[model samples]
Target: MNNTYLTTEELAGRIKYDARTIRQCLKDSVLLEGKHYIRPFGGRKILYIWEIIEEDMLSSAQSNLTIPMANGAVWHG
Candidate 1:
């Protein structure tokens, strides 16, 4: 239970994205609710799981390093 919980603004600072963009664009599209964030105690406030999102970001960055090949294959770079 040592996960780093972050407010929207705090997360925006760490990830260099606008808090507004995160709320409007990425909230449900990219960042999922239960997995990446949560509304504690059925309240309105949101808290993000920093470690999970960081890992996903790193993995997504690594995924982009691959070269797309023929027949739906990808050459990992």
Candidate 2:
């Protein structure tokens, strides 16, 4: 894919967030592990896919889209 892999610090810089916040807050919530990023060589170090994150960010910015919940799914209000 010739895509560029970015470290936590690099991603934080691009998003203007602290690396710790990305790991603690965004990881597994907004930015999923396998889908949006991966650990290097199965090591502890995580590398985020810039292209995927960019695409996701753009998609999230679209206000017209809504995730449809399945029947019996938890919903408040």
Candidate 3:
């Protein structure tokens, strides 16, 4: 499926993260430029592919271990 490209601010709003963080962290480490995001041709605007970013975010979440059912106890996975 082809998803519409979104601006940095738009992407930030969808992911609930600051645009600065997206640019600094996910842009290169996870969301690669050109593949996941890119600068508009001959323009200063940046566009992010929603599906790619969202999928990457979900994948990252799955890889990280988060403690569930906290009752004054910590569980390390």
Candidate 4:
């Protein structure tokens, strides 16, 4: 599959989030490594997979009552 890779700044612009927030807050919390982003060539440069991020963002929005529970489970009301 062809994936759209984006830098933090580019993703911030597309998602309307501050680049600093993306790097500091969302980088390893909401946006996980390997799934939402990657360090190319084992270096420090991070590239975000836009397709996966977008998909999760939309899906999370749709499930209003779905809460993240302990032990990696989700609670749906």
Candidate 5:
């Protein structure tokens, strides 16, 4: 698979985000389980897959996509 495994702190360092933020905010909302991370042996410890994360980050950045606004709001980009 050639996956680079990383801890929460390590991923935070690579992505320049707070580890707390990654854990509290971006875990399921952004970084999905089994895709960006895995709980080996169905345990508590989570290992982040760095290659997948890095690839997704770069690909998403390259795509100029925007979040759909609500409440009759609009995006002009």
Candidate 6:
């Protein structure tokens, strides 16, 4: 897996998200530590793994295609 490590600003440009939003909102909520990002040398700087983020983003989007039914079931169309 060729994982691309991206800075917050670089990722923001690629994903069309504001750097502040990525730092404040998506940091610990959607983008998890160690899994989606890494703190090199245990420093404050964060490097996001683009491949992992893309995979998760696509997977989540695909999952969202499934419709929830009232009878406790999902409808995939």
Instruction: Report per-prediction Cα RMSD to one decimal.
Output: 3.1, 6.9, 3.9, 6.6, 5.1, 3.0
Candidates in order, TM-scores: namely: 0.85, 0.76, 0.67, 0.82, 0.81, 0.83
- Local error of candidate 2 at residue 55 (angstroms): 0.4
lDDT of 5 by residue, 1-77 (tens): 68889999999999999999999999999999989999999999999999999989988876755567887775544
Candidate 4 lDDT over residue span 1-77, tens digit each: 99999999999999999999998899889999989999999999999999999999988888777888889998886
For model 1, what is the error of residue 63's alpha carbon versus the real structure, in angstroms, after optimal superposition? 1.1
> For model 2, which pairs clash?
none
| Residue range 1-77, candidate 6, lDDT tens digits | 67899999999999999999999999999999989999999999999999999999998888779888999998985
> Which structure is stronger by TM-score: 2 or 3?
2
The order by descending TM-score is 1, 6, 4, 5, 2, 3
Clashes of each: 0, 0, 0, 0, 0, 0
Q: Which lDDT tens digits does candidate 2 get at residues 1-77?
A: 86679999999999899999998999999899888899978899989999999987877777445555697564433
lDDT by residue (2-72, candidate 1, tens digit) is: 89999999999999999999999999999999999999999999999999999999999987898879889
Model 3, span 5-37: residue lDDT tens? 998889889989999998888777878887898
lDDT of 4: 0.94
- Residue 60 miss distance in model 3 (angstroms): 1.3
Better lDDT candidate (2, 4): 4
Q: Score candidate 6 by lDDT.
A: 0.94
lDDT of residue 75 for candidate 3? 56
Candidate 1's C-alpha runs over 4 A off are 67-74
Q: Residue 10: error of model 6 in Å?
A: 0.5
- Could you tell me how far off, in angstroms, the CA of residue 37 lies in candidate 6 after the best superposition? 0.2
Would you list the C-alpha lDDT of every candidate in the order shown? Answer: 0.96, 0.86, 0.82, 0.94, 0.92, 0.94
Candidate 3's displacement at residue 64, Å, is 1.8
The superposed Cα distance between candidate 5 and the true structure at residue 4, in angstroms, equals 0.6
